[model samples]
Target: MENKIINFGAGPAKLPEEVLKEVQKNLIDYEGTGLSVMEMSHRSAGYFKINEDAMNDLRELVGVPSNYKILFMQGGGTGMFSAVCLNLMGRTGTADYLVTGSWSAKAAKEATQYGSVNLILPKVQKYTSVPRQSTWSLDPNASYVYYCDNETVDGVEFDFVPETKDVPLVCDMSSNFLSRPIDVSKFGVIFAGAQKNVGTAGITVVIVREDLLGKPMKITPSILDFTITEKNNSIYNTPPTFIVHVMSLVFKWIKRNGGLQGMYNNSLVKSKLIYDIIDKSNGFYACPVDKNVRSRMNVPFRIGCASGHEDLETEFLKLCESKHLIQLKGHRSVGGIRASLYNAMTIAETQILADLMESFFGNKKR
Candidate 1:
């Protein structure tokens, strides 16, 4: 455990160490089934139990209401771009999208093909702060009001839920899922890609309020249809059994550690440690995000002010890699350095990063 290298990648991020070890131990034979979960039939008893427990455990972990149906879907969060619009657009001819960052912007653009999409906030060149919601023009008659709870690339997060009044509030929580607790009843549909904080790639966790189901555009793919997938128990076809199995283990790990609140507390601790380095570094390091709306999950910063000191930033990344800390590079759309502190990242590992920033930049060692 002490020897494992720390990972700070955004998606396909680090999972709990214990979960990995348990999977490694059970890879050959699962519960005496004599077959690995990946090799078993989705319809088999082993797979059925795996699927059932995943749903129930997740419901309990998040306190999902009896009226909400938890469904594990595929095609990632991007797939849901179409799934969300197709399923809900039929309720009304339009929807309202609050575009704060890259993900929400993409979602809003996708909705245009299905019906009218009213972007409450126009796109910005650099998303540094979430504009006050008071400036937003929400359409009460729209089918849904959509937003991304956290934007991984922009390092922006909404500290409060947007009130949609009678209209349903839909959210894309792919990057920040499982890192904090949310009121499940407040959202009409909350979907997240599992790779960021829980489980792994290829499966998306979608919690939908029961009343929002059954409406799909005629072109909605059978696999992506929420109503069909839910009715068939997320086994409308061959499901990602291995990912679901891994997710079940991760949920148990979260519950054992301290549930969602515990994860939230840890996130605050980890992110604060790194942000402190940035905050106290003077001009050597800087974070562009508004302190209040800064993401506790993905922290994007620069080595030098304004556009960043490119040469120094390179040296800083090299120092990180040489010390066995990796995936610190920022997204191509916006270049700098990004540290994604997901649920599985340890404070000790985060302290290593914080220490590196202090020693490298604070001392002008470069």
Candidate 2:
């Protein structure tokens, strides 16, 4: 098979080739409709069906309950950093956040500007382990307990859902959404940037519990208000038409790939290959995050090689680039190599990467 660039970039990331092929087929004439999905009116029947199908497929993929509203809103996850705070903070006096890494910290920081914010920082002995829940100081009266679910920067993920009651749970699942199955019932709100698993940038999907609507503070912008968006079906404005169209293709791609079960199994295989290589590589490579909280979606590893080769990641990335492997660099906040194995990543591509890692380290040992 042709091993073109293996795009492991996180967000604005790679998409399934099938999805792209489908888009290409329909780009000029979408299902006999007169216009491209982009050119069609957002309120038009054809376009509305595209929107509806996308939401329905998402609902099926995540097992979203009937009571939840799947909203396709503009702005990335950063927008919801304020939107969630605005809509939910009025219900209770304060908002609580779990600071797993940079994203959660920012979510908390933004929320603090609106209401009393409590930030929960995990107790880390090193960059290697996640703090147990017992170690976390959680507040009972907080409006909603917010967490990143998966930290894209630090490569840390909550292996299991946190146990809380009588409070709504909100999660920013940007990087890892649809990477696997999640218990959607546990969250009062789940928002993700489409750039990651959803499809592209410019659109954010917000899944909010029905009851949580209509509680927006008066200061909340009418567009940012959850109640208003829900009422208008997430089309208060023109909406991100082009992005939504691409997202529909992605949603259809997920369904065609055996739905969630296929995605779950594929993720397990891809993640296990990389993690096992890291574990078995005899300390030549290291995964910093604790194994328990390891993010299967984003695998960040450090390479230890001698002779100015210590900065081997730069060279490794270059090598991968030569072989058409793309975007293997880690985030700036946590410097190293991060391989984002989102749902679109195929097992064959990951195996190619695994072989590259092995060969790279084997040569280093020589």
Best by lDDT: 1
Instruction: Provide TM-scores for the models.
Output: 0.98, 0.95
Error of 2 at 234 (Å): 1.2
lDDT (C-alpha, whole model) for all candidates: 0.92, 0.85
- Please give the lDDT score at residue 328 for candidate 2: 86
**Which window of ten consecutive residues has the lowest lDDT sum in model 1?**
357-366
Candidate 2 per-residue lDDT over residues 294-338, each given as its tens digit? 888889888872111336888888888888888888787667789
Instruction: At residue 302, give the lDDT of candidate 2.
Output: 82
Sequence-dependent TM-score of model 2: 0.95
Candidate 1: TM-score?
0.98
Q: What is the lDDT of residue 238 in candidate 1?
A: 96
lDDT of residue 195 for candidate 2: 89
lDDT of 1 by residue, 1-366 (tens): 345688999989999999999999899999888999989999998899999999999999999999999999999999999999999988888999999898998899888999999989867788888888798889989999999999999999998998888999999999998888899989999999999998899999999998989888889999999999999999999998999999999999999999999999999999999999888877678888999999999999988775788898998899888888989999999999999999999998999899888888757944
